[model samples]
Target: MTDRVLSGCRIIIVEDDYYQAHDCKQMLQQAGAKVVAVTAIVPDLPDLLAEGRIDAALIDINLGHSHTFDFARELQARSIPFAFLTGYDAGMLPDDLATNVCISKPADLHRVVSVIAGLASRGG
Candidate 1:
């Protein structure tokens, strides 16, 4: 495992499901990415963004109480890139966002590493 590949990459995770968030964070941390924050709600997102530099994000399409598109827009406004991590199928995503890359739930650690590497390569 290369520790420096994702060095200094700040990743934000938004998932209402606590276990999933924990698991994802562990995977990301193991890959050498610094997880800035893991939040289950969007109201806290702006604050998190304000507090640090976010290079990329792993956002769940649906929080327990709401969807993440609005938060995605916020990230877009900041020119930060993000990928969706969802249990829901691609069909569940809005057409506009369906083109965005996503990792299905029960994501493989290696695949997650590869995806993050790809995102990093794109300067995400």
Candidate 2:
């Protein structure tokens, strides 16, 4: 990945684990993007989107007892690119969402950063 592939990009992080969220935020910022928010809860997605600029996102599949498929749908409809970072098998994702990318947990930070950078750079 380039040093500034994500420059000026605004990213949202939907992750339940505090440490993972924080680390992802730090890595993305280091890659030159602004992390708009790192949220565990999914309520008021519209309000969340309205709060600031968002170009892409990295989401965990499971949060508490709920899955983030609905949130993914919303982002899809808005033409915002996102990737699921989950420990679960990608087969668990719904067929409608099967086309979207899924990154397994215990991720390579370089790869994660590069993928998000590609998404933001290409308007994916």
Candidate 3:
């Protein structure tokens, strides 16, 4: 039962955990999104973004030694919509970033797909 909720959307996943990244990529693909890239390294994002159009991004807060706050700001500067898909609570993020959509880990695929669809549709 593919919902196709994210049909035609191009997305990137940035998560440090291999299994988590894989699961998210698979789920997004199943939901009719193009999983442009699944990367654990934050520094690889610029190269990946340059490769093609990305409708939205699912970023993890803590990528082991680094964080995605800077990248998130970059995305904002680009006017690209993105959401944090992290295990950490939304309240923990800096005040400016806390307002962005944040989905908890072990999330329901349906909810993930729904939120992504909304974000992508919002000029992403």
RMSD versus native structure for model 2: 1.6
Q: Candidate 2 lDDT, tens digit per residue, 1-124?
A: 3487688999999999888888888889988998888889774668866787678999999998899999899888888899999899999999999988888887778878988987887685
Off by over 4 Å in 3: none
Q: Show model 2 residue runs off by greater than 4 Å.
A: none
- Give RMSD to native, each candidate: 1.8, 1.6, 1.4
Scored by lDDT, the top model is 2
Candidate 3 on 1-120: residue-level lDDT in tens? 367888899998889988878877888899899988788877565777688888999899999899899998888887788999889989889887877899999767677788888999
1-124: candidate 1 lDDT, tens digit per residue:
5555677788888888888889878878878899998888775666776887777888989887889988777776677778898888878777767777889987776777677767766764
Residue 68, model 3, lDDT:
93
The predicted structure with the larger lDDT, 1 or 3, is: 3
For each candidate in the order shown, give its overall lDDT on alpha carbons.
Answer: 0.79, 0.86, 0.85
Better of 1 and 2 by TM-score: 2
Candidate 2 has which clashing residue pairs, if any? none
Clashes of 2: 0
